[model samples]
Target chain A: MDLHVEGVKKVYGDGPTARLALDETSFTVESGQFISIVGPSGCGKSTLLMMMAGLLKPTAGGIRLGSTPISGPPPGVAVVFQDYGRSLFPWMTVGKNLSMAAAADKLPKAEVARRVDEALTAVDLAGTQALYPWQMSGGMQQRVAIARALVVEPTVMLMDEPLAAVDAQTRADLEDLVLALRDRYDMTVAMVTHDIDEAVYVADRVIVLAAHPGRLIADIPVDLGRRDQLTTKAEPEFVKRRAEVFTLVRRPAATSSAGSDAELDGRPSELKA
Target chain B: MPDPSGATSTLTSAPPPPPAGDKAPTTRVPRRKRPFGRRLVSGVSSLWLLVAIAILWQVVATLSPTLYFPPLSKIFVQFGQDWFTGDPSSLFLSQHFFDAALPSLRRLAQGWGLALVVGIPVGILLGRSAVAAAMYFPFIRFWLAEPKSAIIPVAVQIFGIADSMNVFLIFVGTVGLIIVNTADGVAGVDRMTLQTARSLRISPFTLYRRVLVPAAMPGILTGVRVSIGVALILMVISELYATTAGVGYEILLNQQSFKFLQMWSAFLLIGVISVLLNVVLELIEKRVLRWQRREGLSGQ
Candidate 1:
């Protein structure tokens, strides 16, 4: 689905003490595109994602899934939350958890089982049907969460830093798995993360966000060619693009603002305008 | 495959040199098994602690020769002679044990049945609805603290000196606890779980049935166990104060007649029954909450 978030703003608390979490944040994810959002801590990245997922209502402005005008949770959208431990019900086994999503959607029994098996197999956890979530390792548990989302066959997948808790090696492996699944399912995925390298590695386009009333600061296409674990990070272009993105993020707004003001007043170019 | 002896010989003779990063091969002794003597001593010591208490009780009884403080041996002898013999005329069987005990058990069952029927649904409603909780909770708390046994006189006045008065008082005593616990259990379901269910568009009935009830079961069971003890206490107290039959009546009757041994037996019977009830409830709780055991520990 073509997800469009138009001038989305979220304010917490009330009256004079009200704090802006997102300031007129807007973005668009075309159908079947993989987008990653990166930002500093407390940047309202999660708030923005939750708005897009229709989990949290924005204080002002609105979101749309192909002009449907998002209100509450959209029908063809599924979310994979950060805490895998809290996401799945402790009382349920893997099979039961997957089946619950399907059952909620009122899918037929045979179809639910088939989709569950396919989703589990896609995540390389095919034979763990009866295992409870607590019985699995962190990575495996997250895979089960991903499988829960995939079983619904959602058009839009909103992942909130899904691999943040896993070890480095497992995070990389899971990132690859996400990429492979995106290709296989032809899914439109919007992921929020803090890791710059992770944002570049997984996303086709990376949107860098700023904190203190979070707003879009940089939207750069990750043009690193033929991405993989080995070649992706090793490429010279990857290093240059990363440095450029970092520079753009760290640019001093106060000094740059004075220069922009000078240029706006039609000052000569030689005066550091 | 190398033979067992050959493998050992190779291991000893080869003595592979340690790698640059390797530390010295320190021998680790397998944990020594506790000798049978030590194990036996520990086991016997635990038993002795309990036996010592029993002996102390016997010593106290033997020293005091008071009517109220009968020796444990004399009580046991009276219990065997009166209750164990086939003859229905025995004091333990005929007058004290059956005539008094069976009626009390029957009254407890009746009163507890009434409490469960009224308390459970009310508890569930109060738990789920804030408005209901606000309306009923203060009243329940007030009644719980009002010394319900004090109402036995009023109950007798209202229902007359009949089984009805006793059962009514027992219900009044026990029902408040069940209601409060049930409400608490229902309220204790995780907020996120409820949110997930709501996000999934689960119907209200299904949410209650599938998520709320199961989540609150441990709390509900706790309430039930607590109510059982209350029920037992109420049953005996009501019978002792004003009743013709039941175990409590037997105790009161024996005390009046100065049949101290018979009174003691009645108290013993009540204690045994209460413990048995508690044990059965605990077994049931373990079975019902098996899934919760590991989670409860890890959560703590």
Candidate 2:
């Protein structure tokens, strides 16, 4: 189902102590689309993702999955957190952790087992079911985290910097793994990342946000024909898109207060002019 | 895009498939499975200092041979007479073994068992809920601070010199520590693990059972170990008051009658029993915490 973040705002505390974390952010992630929300640190990208997952409520407006407003964690939504060591239960074996999603849904024993095995296979961690997360490498543990999300057969998979902790090679491999899984399952994915090229490489469209009360800056579509770890990234069009996002990310003011100066100038030429 | 040059180097290399035998780092540290004879030899080697201490003790006692401090050999003889000597058909365990040692063992079990059964849930409740802890933690802390020995007379008054008084004293001595350690364990549960549980939308019951309890187990087991020691100490103390059948009572009876060697034998037996009980508990702890051993996270 499509996820709608309609005029969502999050302000922590009250009155003078109140700090705006996100300001009237609005976006609709079309069903089955691979969307990446990218920005600088403290851009509230994670906060927005958490709100979308219904783990956090927006201070104003609302988030809706299809027609349902998410007041609490909605069904058919799974989150893959950044810190796999913290996110995955160290006591449980990889299989047990993966199967937890299915078990939480109270699926039949046989069905849960089947889904666990299937999800592990999807993440290329087929035989690691019995191993603990810490026993494996960082990359492998993140795979277990992703496999955990897959077990639920979620309509939307929200990843919060899931590849941030791994090595560069491992990050690329996982990036491809997520893209492959998205294609195979036709999964709707809303990933929050800080890496510009990473956001451009995997996402069908990239939503860029500016920090200090995060607000949407650009909703640029990535149309470099097809994505590849090799040729697609080397393409001129990909470079142009990456530079565009970098410019938007670097110039915080233009995106920080959208259209105010544009209305005065009668043209928003400062960005993508 | 990282310099495509360096990034591409490892791009083609698939993560080495988990090794066939023990390639995974988690599987690398094998639990030591020493042969029985070797384990015994190692055990004996580890106890050499204690053996030396025993020899020194024997030498000192032999040289002095006071009425109160009799020779080790005489005490060993008394010990043999008290528990080891018996008819050939009774497996050489004397009547004193069944009377004195059995009751003591029974009381220890009852007291320690009650402590665990009561302490764990109360601990988890205190750890998880702020209101429950706010209401009860100070009370528990107060109880812990107060001398447990002072409660013996009160217990004797209520239970009237029965086994219940002995069991109650042991319970009083140990339960508070268990509750505290268990609460610490519950509080120490990694934040991310709780977040994972919340994300999964697990029920409150399973959240505690599958997630909270196991996470806090290592701490609870530590509490159990310390509580066992406390329980044994309280058992001996409680038995000294009005008990007639237990090890402590035997020591007091023998001492009052001026059978100093027999009293020493009871003391020796109590020491041996305490060591044996601790060993048993350690073995059980090792078995229960086998996974922790693999992670090298266990206290042992």
Highest DockQ against the true fold, candidate: 2
Please give, for residues A47-118, the per-residue lDDT of candidate 1 as tens digits: 999898887899888999998999987777888888887777766778887877676688888999999977
Across B1-300, the per-residue lDDT of candidate 2 in tens digits comes to 122233223323332333243223334335579899999999999999988987887899888767988777788888999989988788898998889988998998998889889999899988888888899899999999999999988998999979988988888889999999999899899987887888898888889988999889899999999988888889898889888789999999999999898899999999999999899989988876665643442111
**What's the lDDT for residue B63 in model 1?**
85
- Candidate 2 per-residue lDDT over residues A1-273, each given as its tens digit: 899989888876765556677767788999999999998876789999989888888988899999999998778999999988788887788878887777668899889888887777666666667776666767778888998999988888999999988878788878887887786666799999999999999898999988765678889998865567778888988999999999888885543547522332111122221
Looking at model 2, residue B166 earns an lDDT score of 92
DockQ of each: 0.12, 0.28
Model 2 clashing residue pairs (backbone)? none
Tell how far residue A269 is off in model 1, in angstroms.
34
After superposition, the stretches of candidate 1 with alpha carbons farther than 4 Å from their true spots are A224-226, A244-273, B1-50, B59-66, B73-103, B113-121, B129-132, B185-188, B295-300
| Deviating ranges (above 4 Å) for candidate 2 | A253-255, A260-273, B1-45, B86-92, B294-300
